[model samples]
Target: MDDDLRERVEREAEKHALLNAVKHESDADVGAVMGPLMGDNPEFREHADAVPGLIGGVIGRVNDLEYDEKRARLEELAPEELAEIEAEDEADEHDLPDLPRADDHDEIRMRCAPNPNGPWHVGHARMPAVIGTYKQRYDGWFCVRFDDTDPETKRPDLEAYDAILEDLDYLGFEPDATFKASDRLDIYYDHARKLIDMGGAYTCSCSGEEFSELKNSGEACPHRDKDAETVLSEFEDMIGGVYDSGEMVLRIKTDIEHKNPALRDWVAFRMIDTPHPREEAEEYRCWPMLDFQSAIDDHIIGITHIIRGIDLQDSAKRQGFLYDYFGWEYPEVVHWGHVQIDAYDVKMSTSTLSELIEDGELDGWDDPRAPTLKSLRRRGIRGEAIVDAMIGLGTSTSDVDLAMSTIYANNRELIDEETDRRFLVRDGNEVPLGGSPPDEANPQLHPNHEDRGVRKIPVGDAVLLESDDLPQREERVWLKGLGCFQYTRDTLQYTGEDIEVVREGDVDVVHWAPARESVPVRMRTMEGDVTGRAEPGVAELATDEMVQFVRVGFARIDHVPSGVADDSSDDELVVYYAHP
Candidate 1:
């Protein structure tokens, strides 16, 4: 290869390696480095014999450079410029699916209606991510509506309402409008009256068991054919509190022998005397069923598009009756299958989660074991990671059962570059040094970015090493960047400053912290709390700052040094482990 061509190939290869390493937060593979270089410069392939050597040289050079430097350089570019680059990169991946008939609309409107019975879980994130993307694509409005009408079975909690909103905000969705179903009780009541006057609905006074038997047998209830005048009168009686709970229910008129049993005359409203957490106590005795309230709200709020799970298709059919009665067009509907992550094993239902919390089986909704969004956030899982994973799934109708690794992989891509690195020694064993220890050891804040500066940890004659990393037999080991050491039992005898000597010995390299300068660390892992010791600098980290605990995994600092001198800084630092 000519000198000029060789230089160009080398430069391109270096850029490719740097970008890849920065993105993945790990060493770039030879194939990953060469693929982009070869694609960008086809001429390089002509000299295939020299290509491997050139790529290897470039990779070595790139490895010498710190990741934070590349990240800082990338951040120097304008926001729009960065976005364009990301757009091009994402297009190359072709991960996001195209919206169905996205170009045909002048305006698009979408909503995510979540019942505020409990905090949102990871599954709940799919709707906002999917709907938010469509809203962005078509430059339309996005809304969040709390469907909290049920007070008996799925009662609403004030904390749950706030938590759901907080999760949405963390996911980067700002709703153009917000609605609470309880606040629209008057509107639902008016719609029920309209259905009754139009002879499309009637009040039924059948016992619970009697109605269930009749519906199961495809037989109409005795009151199903009541005239509008009498039905209206009975509905008035229900509103007047003359009917006890489960004794009276307003049913929407549908096919008595509909092919699907669930589609047969569905109940629209029921009498519930339970007090709502937010609304007045027992002020409204009649509560509209979810389908009834949602249908009315969707129409009244002028929702143009409805994207939801395929399981709710029956709900659409039920709501269709009301739409027909009021002479209103049903919004365009699209359904996708459930996105199930069976690796969690834990149930994601709000009612079940509430029970678990009540029984003290969980620390709280934000516990690392729970799949709630608050828990994910506490563990340092970014909203962008959730968005990427959801969008990658697209709108497939088939049910998807994914492993936890699916999300962890997505999260690693986004966090690896940004999260700082720190050393942690769990269940530490004292390793006494033979030679004099240096006063301080400086390690780069990030391996790939030297320009980001170093973190200085005070050194001593003894260092804390993870119990697992203790040498079982005499062997040469590298004590990270500080120097080489000869390990024998609990002794880490200083040998030389050259890391190459330890690397050549074919021994394991382990991370350690100076015994005197280290601070206690308690990480809340998915399994349980793991106590350890981390470098003193770890205690200085700001709340919510994500950091990789060297061999331990990534974690988010949950507690930091408080301003008051309460000795909290001396206490074990608390963190929530994100993932390995």
Candidate 2:
């Protein structure tokens, strides 16, 4: 470590010592002593919140010394505690409670229901990981369900479902089974019929605006007093395409006079003229609403647990009432706060992200910055990193502004160890335009990891180096991980791979390549603008190969087009996501 950094660490350690001294004092006010210590240093204060146990470590270190002696020594000079603080910080990060146990209990089945209107976002990404974490740790089973009841908002494409599956697969989420609300129309119809027979459902012929006004005014509709047989027949007619969209709706029989508007005879089924993605438009005209479908399906599917965001907490109670009305078993409810993105100061919405992608401002659903599972995966973020970040956030009943950096940092730590180093030099200009001399060149494909071993570059009388490496003034410079070199007016000599020779006059010591030898390559990164080249042979690299371009960052070989011979028009494509 640098001297300045070492001194800063030492000062922090001494503060830790002083804080410990005050804590151990007979009649000492702990906060009074530590508050000043924290107030004096921002770094110490920020880390102190996360590393509470560090105080214990500091106390232990001072055990051998007398209390007064320790205080005196601490006051004299600061001590280094960088490593200890970092270790403690890492220890507490992302350690959430174990999932609830279902061993002795049969009531632990849960399902994640996502509307298949678009691809999954980071907010939706949490569902599978959280549910999977619980299922594995608590011996629970998770089901993937599609809430596809609203045909108006639903697109007539299966690509969304396919993309959802792809996102889940990328994150290693495999549900025991998949269910769609559209598939169980009969079950919903049966429940609606039961409600009708029980006087819990009725057909409403009120116009849209009139119904809205009546609902808003907390007044019972005149149709609520209609005979059960009449309402049942009307429901059948609605189902038989006897009514057009918005002409009639099957409203549940609830207290319209009740202050709670949601329970005020809400519509349980609606007539839609639009076609369903899973079922043809001509097959049926009436469809059960979300609440109605969810209530019945949860009972029939034997779901023992309902884990969802806090926004659905009331929906759980509403569903429970339906369960009670039917005398059916209801699942236990566990609701967590919403995952709020700090950037927008609002809940993360897939629709918003999709709109951005559609407009061409964002790359796609998998754009590294898109906050989707596939985006994170393509950015080389491990699933475990996301799990750790979410679980660490803790389950609170209050909304939180989730910072994107937290996940990125978590991802960096998780991926750092697995990434093999490769040198990549961009905007290079130092090497001679002709190439490095045969004797002075010894290029290695993979550094620090020989298991992924060597990829020999064609280093003859022609080669390239990053153009930015060239300094304005002629000076001896190191080629990083390679060796040193000396530069002159417009070029630099190919010094032996290990050493350099000084040359007179100012010259740009930049990353450069032998004119036609090193093939220029392009890549698509999140932040954009990555233009580099490797030996023409790099075009032969197979797709999806993880490689590090020397002096540049690590990248995945995306594809090498066909007909691009090993020695010809090199068209190797590398994939990077905001790598610095």
Candidate 3:
């Protein structure tokens, strides 16, 4: 039994070592290598005394194999190939920005609190990467708190709560804890009472227009001078449903004569009758405002750092009073300016996007035209690329207005190596060949990665070409991977098989698909959908599989023809173009 147990552990250890070697491209540490073995093979734990020696032996053998393979590959590679690999390694070291240092004794804690009013857009997606990076850097805890207090203006949608979580997960960020502001109403109520008892807040029954006039003139409302006992009574009445919506509000006592009008006795809590999607609305009539709720939550939740946009600077200022009133230290606030990619030319607000979707202006939040995170994911943009682009911009205060090319360039570098190449000709026009073509044309799946193998596309006498690719005059053109041809009217005269020959001349290199073997293609770009024809192999791609359409750009398969169980090569292939 002991011998059998030892042999099984040894075999598992060896298998793990080889997997680690391939993953890390080198020998993994014995401690790191043991993690998987112990978790996967409980029998190894039972025979723990023999595990260390077994792990060491397996790691040693794997290291030897890795060294031999690396050495042989180095000998086969050209000098430029070696230099390029070294350069890529160096570039990776500086990909993400260096986080600012924090106090060592402070328990690092970060929160991504988003309002669950609408689906997350590209702008909202930025927070997860930024907050996730800080958490990773400080080895801190991350919390996803839904700020669903405002039901009148920005109404919370129940579906958006799950959608937001899905977006965060897709972006490689998983929260250590999840919370909803509505669930913590009792806590907010307790804090509100504390503020009232401390004489830092009071109840105001002034009408909106009357309060606006007083606030603009830096004059206090008549209710501001009420004693704590009086204010507490009114607050109880407000919470007890005695006050109608907008009839009364709880105002934090800030300097009425303060220069900033917004800072002049801001409303801390307000009466709203609208029922919360996830809560009993009638039970809680007075809801804490955004800044007030955020301040209380931040301190109670032990948030050490707050990363947000610079536009919310006033929020920090307003929350400062509450922090000071309670004698609590505020979290270190890091602010970044807006990131505008003008090429998208769409409104970045979730409310606006929601309206558009409601009005049938957009298909849905995942429509290729929309800049929602789901749309980006559907369009084949990797979450890592989004992180890279955002981190590359760093946490600067200056607003950045860049072209879509900036993001596309960052994304292209990430997907270039992994994406398989396929042919797609838009509005395909038949090109008749003068002579018989080769039986098959094999193109490398990736131009730089030979190990990816080749895709064999059958070649026939007639091929479908993009109508735009055909020149008005007779000229040589290279049909990629097949052969070169010269077009005269409708007939393409055979030139030569050498691509170099066509390259040396004024020939246009174009991609083509076998006329009969081509599948119907519809590519959804940011502008609109473009109808075309793709190689038959494209239909074999699984949903969400990203591929490059030779001169067209990268795209992810959105849908294949319905009921085609195995491969839908003969059916319509729908894809969402990510970027060029």
Candidate 4:
């Protein structure tokens, strides 16, 4: 490469490094810097191999400088990029890119199509978040379309349709309109007839193996040459239940000699004996394939744009034939790569999760282990956190891997200041007091918010301390908000009530609950169940209220032993741990 081009690449790479380091207050990553480094500088595109080394060299220099130095260098190098960072910091974290050919259209129309075979998983939430953003950006109408056509394989659960709408509302992405593919069977059949009449589609009675052989050999099936009238007649019979399941099929016409076999003639519709879950489709046995049905609906509903995974790029190629035959303008399409959440080890397959639930291994869809939106919500994960985490991913065509820590951090920011603190002693031991202390100790419910109130914990003869937090031999410990204690020989002796002395001596502060008013706390965490003892006030909080366990972590009150208010009967306080 020429010296001028090489110099340009280095300058661009340095700009990203400085901007990244200044914004994050940390060392810039080679992978993180590479995207903008090459994106803004097309001159360096041909030298892809050299870009990483250039970025690496730049990151080292950027990392070595102080935070202020990095900011100053970035402003000096590219003042606009520094200003952009400041603006981004003050605004929302997720700023999606503009739509392609957005200005050419007068109005924007979008859809988030999901198969209602099961409740929405975390991965399924992305489409609505992203597409809804565009809908809002353009003041356009958005539709939540259910692609619940495959009854025999992915049978749509009747409950999932409503459940998905509830999730959208929870995520603040409620659609302006909603519909299902099963309700539009006649629409698909109408398109199929026109397609056959236009000589763009045909019905094949050959077995699956025979068709595969013909397709692999770059040849059409024997029925491919049938006239339009004859083909339509056969298609009608196929839909009229003349053929049993898998006995006949309708195939869309593509390039017979196409190099990619998948782009070659593909199945447009197939017969299935298993009725659709929805009553409207119960009488129908023939179902239109996903691509054909979705493509037709996109045109019929005037979808201006389509967002899909790059893996299904072939759908566009295959569906283009039908569009051309019908002389319909195809909607602008954008393909995004897969998003692999590193936190979830299981594949985001509904069938796999359903089987596990049926086997009694999973405690239904909302189990903390299941990677569904319901699970995250029940575990005290806010809807905003899920939306932010997904929108922050943007619509990159390259596969993106992410850790769930980002979501947890975002959720913490939203709930940390609001949730009141409570003391929970896991696996407790009764420790007697050595001195005559006050009858009770009151700790601030929230350290920062004194106006909220305090937990009036009665100090009896002894206090319940977590077995793990018990003062070691000769070690001094401060029972938070109560008093200091020193463990000597086999006794825990109270030292003094002064907080300054404990801080001066650098004593360990451990959480404790009054032994007299203790309640059995059953905590459900992602790792496993934790049986703990909490102050009586913990059981008084309303269910679903978020609270933080002192020295432990944040958790939501799932259920308090029923009738705790009516009598002295003690019941377990069940809570779900959020995160540390």
Candidate 5:
């Protein structure tokens, strides 16, 4: 192939390779890049057989760059195409369908009852995000009720209550009111008494094993036939600590021959010797089951609609028995399937996460590796991004897998423009500079905006470049806004500020920070810690400010000690890597 033809084909190959890598958030495939290359340059067909060989080295080098570098380079080469991709992705989140029978109620109300075992994860976002959006739509009241009555199993963490409120606030799912079932035991007991008097419930002393056998056989326990007065007396005894844990239970009266064995007179309340977590509720020995307490609380709170998982359809049915017994109408219930967000590497279950925390596998609920909302927040994720991504999943009845990329795309829109561009070279190598480059240069903080005026970048002394970005001996390269330079005779010699030279040279552009303007940086990512040096301006920004590192993705400055400019503190700049 002629030199001119070879150059054109290789440039096209590099652009397509970068585009492919951006799509998958990884290296490009030869098979994929080839198709786009030929389509864009139909004249290359005559050389098709030699095309692969010609573009092989180009594709390999493009793949050799980091995801952020590929993305950044693509931004420069194909700004229009890249912006179109962003516009296309920004619209992927669907607006939720209107609520059914929205006008039938005088007022719309909803409740999210979470068991306070651990911090909320990504899966937990659906309930609050969806409800919060609905709440705003209807001007309805959203309530948060903590299911913390289970003291023995799923013990409530005292800190979790506040943490949940914080998480809710972070997600913009602020609740109109919050309640804990632990604090409402007396109310649950009052309802228990009324049910006994109404002959809708009875105290059963049969052991769990004995009752399971009877329930499965479609036979009532011996205590099932007790009169309301007798039932009330036994219920009071059970509440007054007359029975040990598992010695007795308050069973709602249902059909003895119910088709589903689990619905056959399910236990409403039980004796638990373990004290409650809250100081005010510590005196109680009898605790209500989730279904029983949540049902009663939902009605009392005047929840007009209930949103829950399809797995809890049985619980809704079980609660229906009690609703019917009290001659009360059941709230409108919306059941959705479980959500699967495979993008996050951590386990979704609170129980599992709590165990991991206990075993010292994680630092805490806010560990970057954890899927908790707090962790995402610490990692520079905006709540708007989470809500947008979650709402896009929709409340369908089939298990759905959510791509984290959707969230990243959503977050990029919110943070990319606001954040100033910075540079952080991982495993930094000091590259000698022997150029006519200025001592410092001013560049736009964001590519799309020139008015932000974040700061000017220092460009003197030595440059710290990622080892891979270092040009080989005698190789020419663009210095990104500085100028074109050639690494020859042991130095990166100035080749004048000429864009044509860079294009004609067909050399890779690399980002760098002057050693004088850069400070030691340690970025914490899910994979591991990467040590490097970033622009000192990054440390100057307030902690938690999201900064886009040129060719290095975005990161949130988690820690910036006081007097960093004077080296008065020992703490180094610590940032948490958010996404590519």
Candidate 6:
């Protein structure tokens, strides 16, 4: 026997002998009588020598068995008992977040203002997860603030906004309240006036390139010498659209020659001609720039913690200047490194991905390949799995690009059990003489997963198998958890290309079917045309039911119109969403 097998056999034998010896111990004294004969006997002596090590090994094996038997015993248990066990097990495995130790000094209460210029991407996803996590653990509020200050780059209307909310919602995330920068124009304007009255801000009518050059050369602009009153008048004129677009901007009166040019008189507000989505055109013209608007809003909204990406690390400095300028309280900021995926070897960008979605180069934001929340769902990613993934990474500032497959596989492990199992026949062909599916075919559900007790699958004389398996058939094949089979094929029909049909030689074949009429559907994959088949009617499965087709992997129901549920016509049908 191989070393591993031999070790296992010897281990088992030792375990059996120890138990027998222990039971018979009551029959005699060990040192005076039992030890002498047992020590002399070859088998007894061997077992005695190995018993302790084998006992240790047996305990380890028992632990392994219990771990894999998560949902197994439910197959034969009462529903109530099964539920109790499953719930208890879930509670036992529930992971608690590692909350920061509350030092009296560690305070956070803030809004997460994301520019809705594009759909939420990977880095954007992580920020909210971390923010929501901190908000929950620290008793701080996190609001989804639409940073709509810059209309030049913002997408008009609610398309991107709606999608962002949908993605966050799907991931079990929510904010305490929703706010938009556009709603706080008056607030920002008031702050601008405060800075002007304090002689800390001035309006400059420099061209873009002039300001760019000034910023680069660290040279003071001649326009910087104007008094606060004259600067205030120009600021009012700019807001009143007295100045043409991009003609002049209200800039903080910081040292123009400061070593860090970004700290040197950054523009606090600028002119914009476009209409704000949340405000009427007549309501505003000059917009508060990012740092200026964020600092004021953060103080006003009582935001104490600001979690953001490391790319914006300098933002902390600019924001600090704004807070200092206005003498406003600043929030504690946490910046984590951005996430990149190796498959693409670049950062994920919402704007780039949105263009792909708009140009028809990609499906909707939820396309399986897109990496958006919807895409992850379609790919059978589990919420718990995502939580696990994020938790394992922890909060760090080091840059990293983990493999997409690693996260997918991590979530897949959690998803496989929660979902039911089905069989999928890619390029379908039927098997003959399927030992008649029992009149009432009910396979023991998961032997241990009582919550998912016995499942009843339709069995018939002839069952379908995947086309790929037809030509590769040999003498025997196993039908998953079912029995084994032998098979042979007749001259199966084949299309000119590659599709084929085959006879069931002698094998128990298993595959999914509508058991009646299947709902015609298309599935997406990297190579495309993964499997297109009609699914079972919606009435048979629970709305939230997740299932893996035996050979084809996992799938969920898409929200759509079907005869089984809504009365809408086929053409009017919307896919009712489901996931594995």
Q: Ten-residue segment with the worst summed lDDT in candidate 4?
A: 42-51
Return model 2's CA RMSD, one decimal.
9.1
lDDT of each: 0.78, 0.62, 0.78, 0.82, 0.82, 0.58
lDDT of 6 by residue, 1-580 (tens): 1245336444444333332333232212222222223223333321222223334444344334332242242223234545554565557342333333335445656576888876676556666666666666667677888888887666444577787777677667788888878877888888888888888888888898888898889888778878888988998898787876788899887777778876777888988887666544335778888888888888888776777778887778877877787677667666777666654422377777778878987777776556566666665566555655665555678886666556555655555446555444455565653433233334334322456766554444544556555545444543433344445464222122210111122332344342333334445554444544433432355434555554455566554443542323442212222232
lDDT of 1 by residue, 1-580 (tens): 4567667777777667766776677777776665456545655533433466667877886677677765554445334544555676667454546555656666777789998888888898999988888777778987889998888888888888788888999898889999888888889888898889998998888887888788888999899889999998888887777877888999999988888889889999899877788845347778889999999999888888898899999999999988999999888888999998755556987777788889999889898888888888899888888887888787888998656666776787677666777888887888788866567878668654557888888878789988777776577766664666777666877776664343233545678888877887888987888977888888788898999877677899998654321334456688999987
Clashes of each: 4, 33, 0, 0, 0, 37
In model 1, which runs have C-alpha deviations exceeding 4 angstroms?
A: 1-56, 60-105, 342-345, 502-505, 561-570
Candidate 4 residue-wise lDDT, 1-580, digit = tens: 4456557777888888887788888988765675456445644533443345555677788888989888888889989979988998987644888889999999999999999988888888788888877888888888989998899888999988998888898788878888899999999999899889889898898999998899999987898899999999999998898899989999988889999988888999999999887887899988999999999999988899999999999999888988888989999998998887767655677888888899997898888778888888888989888788888898999998767877787787688778888888998898877767777778888754568988888878788887777878888877776777788766667777566544343566678888767777888876668887887788789989999887677899998877443324356778888876
Per-candidate RMSD vs. true structure? 8.4, 9.1, 13.2, 11.4, 9.2, 12.5
Once fitted onto the true fold, the runs of candidate 5 whose alpha carbons sit more than 4 angstroms away are: 1-94, 562-570
lDDT of 2 by residue, 1-580 (tens): 2345335544554565554553444322333334334434534421221222333444355555666776566545543443343355667433445434445466467788888888887777677777777777666687888888877765434677778877777767788889877777777887788888988888988998898899889877988888889988998898788899989998877667767776677778999988786643337668888888888888887887677789776677566657777888676666788877553322357777767878997777776556677766765666676776777666666876677667656664444334543434454443452225453333434322345654344444434555445544456554432344556565655455432221111222222344445555666665564766654555666665555443344466666776443334354345554232
Candidate number with the higher TM-score (1 or 5): 1
Worst 10 residues of 2 by lDDT: 499-508
The full ranking of all candidates by TM-score, starting with the best, is 4, 1, 5, 3, 2, 6
For candidate 3, what is the lDDT? 0.78
lDDT (10s digit) by residue, model 3, range 409-434: 66776776678889988988987777
Evaluation by lDDT, superior candidate among 1 and 6:
1
